[model samples]
Target: MFVHFGLYAVAARHEWVMNREEIEAERYARYADVFDPDLFDAAALARTAKQAGARYVVLTAKHHEGFCLWDTATTDFSAAEALMAMCRELQPHMIVNDRLGIPGDLVTPEQYQPSRPLERDGVPVLWEACQTAPRDAALFAAIGEWMHRHRRAVHGAGPSAFTAPSGVTYTQRGDRLYACLFDWPFGLLHLPDLAGRVRFARLLHDGSELRMREIPQAQQAFNMNPAAPPPGTLTLTLPTRKPEVALPVIELLLWDSP
Candidate 1:
């Protein structure tokens, strides 16, 4: 279970309310004055997670908005020490997403960590927050489901050289390659990198096999120059109807791991 609670809760708006609305820092700091989390019971939260069969809970101690949920000597703009102690007691693995002028156990990609070390007790676990509107349950569910389905690729995969149209990103994990398509193409998706490397292709969503073929690059008028490299255009036939998900992923099994 993951929980996000801070001064932003006082505004009853999204987490990035300060930045998205372009409010001044001093003006936005006033939210901390009225921030009263009287109903925030860390023990009750832990009990609820246990009832729901959750293994662990991750609480956002400080978000990108730079509002600290715990009291610190560096800033008076804090929720105070009592809440932080309770949270630490209930949830030891707290996530401090912003630089609060204090040392933290973990650091996110967006944070600047020049003075602090990346790892201390163990390998630092990187946390990536998915920014989404409140109550957008479908999108959240889709993202969580996608991550769960491709847990191996999510952890072990790295950026791939494989090329695709706009809104598409590629990642490869050993013999398997993944293409995350954010925008649905018309009817055909072209991949220029995996010309002869792809052994199989399928949609990850429903395990639907897709038809694919390679076209010689020389066949195109753009490659009229004899010095031009040999053309190997790999195109996958996509379904006319797009899948019902936040993002669609196409899995490619390569003949050789690159």
Candidate 2:
């Protein structure tokens, strides 16, 4: 009720459109227009993302300034012409809201209220709080304390320092000398390399040149599926097969996959 009321309040107060073209143009100026819908044909973007080895395509139908890619009956200035027709013409496509406000009584399944991710504003816990509850200083602080490691957020929280084990070398007794990781997804251990790969093998405590190999990708059990992660962790080890060897340097590489 409060959520609807808030949206209503904001919407009602928003200036009523005086002219349609200006409204659409303003949408772009406000950074509200993300996807032109016309720029990329439906089949084309999918093919391109697949061929480019991109895992996902973020079509910015809307941003903070509030623009939607498709036509909205709600507004006269809604997307028309190019892509609006595509959504109606296309098939086998599914859309999950990139923005799910908050979960629970504040939101209903049909109306949609999703928990916000922190990566948008750059700071995970603390910065995320600013984005979501920017006015609420106490809430952000509490979140920051809860996410001391800063890796606990739903989306990437940008570059923050982390701790790792200390060891220069170890015995790869039979096959591998490995390390352990707790409280993280099995994806790339780090991020922020626009160059598209993370190279951090230099942090190995044991100091042995680490070989980059494709370890079998492990599927996270449904129980571990994340709407959010409970304060949890896991252990990871590598194969070395020696009694004494330089510690392995692990490089976390992020790339889209099939």
TM-score of each: 0.56, 0.23
- For each candidate, C-alpha RMSD in Å? 8.6, 18.4
Model 2 lDDT per residue over 44-111, tens place: 54554444333355554543344444567654444443334454468325433323442211112343
Summarize candidate 1's per-residue lDDT along 1-258 as a digit string, tens digits. Answer: 667888888888777888899989999989988988998889977765555444467787877787777887655435545545665789897654434444444455453323222443685444443333344545445556666555545566665656655777777888989888978987778777677888899988788899988755445445422222235657888999898756788999999986
Alpha carbon lDDT at 191, candidate 2: 17
Candidate number with greatest TM-score: 1
Q: State the lDDT at 214 in candidate 1.
A: 71
lDDT, model 2: 0.32
List runs of model 2 lying over 4 Å from the truth: 1-39, 75-258
Can you give the lDDT of residue 6 in candidate 1?
Answer: 85
Candidate 1 clash pair list: 217-231
